[model samples]
Target: MVKEGLLDILKGNFLVSDEASKNWRFLLFASVLAALMIASSHQADKKVHHIADLTQQVKTLKSTQVKHKREIQQLLLESRLKEELAPIGLGVPEQPPAKIQIVSQP
Candidate 1:
């Protein structure tokens, strides 16, 4: 009997047998689970790729920020300021600034 059952399974006859109706619900549930697992796997892959792309963008933005910071620091130097202002005839004062004292009459 066991050999016959195994033979029937191997020959795919069990799928058409009367007992097959009893397993339809379980088969449908398993198929749904398999499809959900595939969809979840694809969603996970998309998130991973998105994270990688964002990481690359962050690296690029960081490098650009560093470049701009360096340029700003260079421009803030007194020598660079003097060079930039030379064309406009602006220069450091040669004499000290004077402060005037006012006397209040009582």
Candidate 2:
């Protein structure tokens, strides 16, 4: 199998080992290393995906913040305009716009 060949290539120490348990030791070591590599790669992919999703969320929040700021500015402008028109009675209503009062002379 491909796994066995790669495992043999990685276990260079096994070729020089004189002990009968050398094969078991080398295979176990190689298997552990390969597992670690696989786990690290999977973790790295998850981290990258999380970062990308966070970036998109940040962009969306930034856009929403800008829109809220614009709305606040517009409301402020409207309030100031209303204040300026208050003396001449152009916008706000102490009375209706079409209503007028006349005085009677004796």
Candidate 3:
């Protein structure tokens, strides 16, 4: 009888047997785990793409920052400032600057 039952199970006839009813909960749990694994994999892929996009944005912003900083440094040079001021008739004085000390009344 036991050999006949084992043969029945091996022949894909276990679902019609009493053991299938007893293992319904295990089957349900396995299905849920499989669904969760699929969801987790999709979420991981989304995060990877998001990180790549952010990394590219950072690189673009860094290059822009470097370019702006170079432009600002070039504009702030003494020769550049003098040239710009000359157009406004504001050239630096040739005479040495004098300092005046104030004396307070006693």
Which candidate achieves the best lDDT against the true structure? 1
Order by TM-score, highest first: 1, 3, 2
Q: Please give the TM-score that candidate 1 achieves against the real structure.
A: 0.84
Query: Tens-digit lDDT track for model 2 on 1-106?
Result: 9888688669865566576387778778999999999999999999999999999999999999999999888767978889877798788667667866898998
Worst 10 residues of 3 by lDDT: 14-23
lDDT of 1 by residue, 1-106 (tens): 9999799879988678788876677789899999999999999999999999999999999999999999999999999999999999997889988889999999
Kindly provide the TM-score of model 2 when superposed on the true structure, using C-alpha atoms.
0.58
Candidate 2 — which residues are off by over 4 angstroms?
A: 1-20, 78-106
Clashing pairs in 3: none
* Candidate lDDT values, in order: 0.93, 0.85, 0.91
Q: Estimated TM-score per prediction?
A: 0.84, 0.58, 0.79
RMSD of 2: 11.3
lDDT of 3 by residue, 1-106 (tens): 9998789868968666577875677778889999999999999999999999999999999999999999999999999999999988997799989999999999
Q: Sorted on lDDT, highest at the top, how do the candidates line up? A: 1, 3, 2
Candidate 2 at 70: error in angstroms? 0.6
C-alpha RMSD of each candidate structure in angstroms = 2.3, 11.3, 3.0
Compared to the true structure, candidate 3 yields what TM-score? Answer: 0.79
Candidate 1 regions with alpha-carbon error over 4 angstroms: 1-3, 99-106
**Residue 29, model 2: Cα distance from true site in angstroms:** 0.2
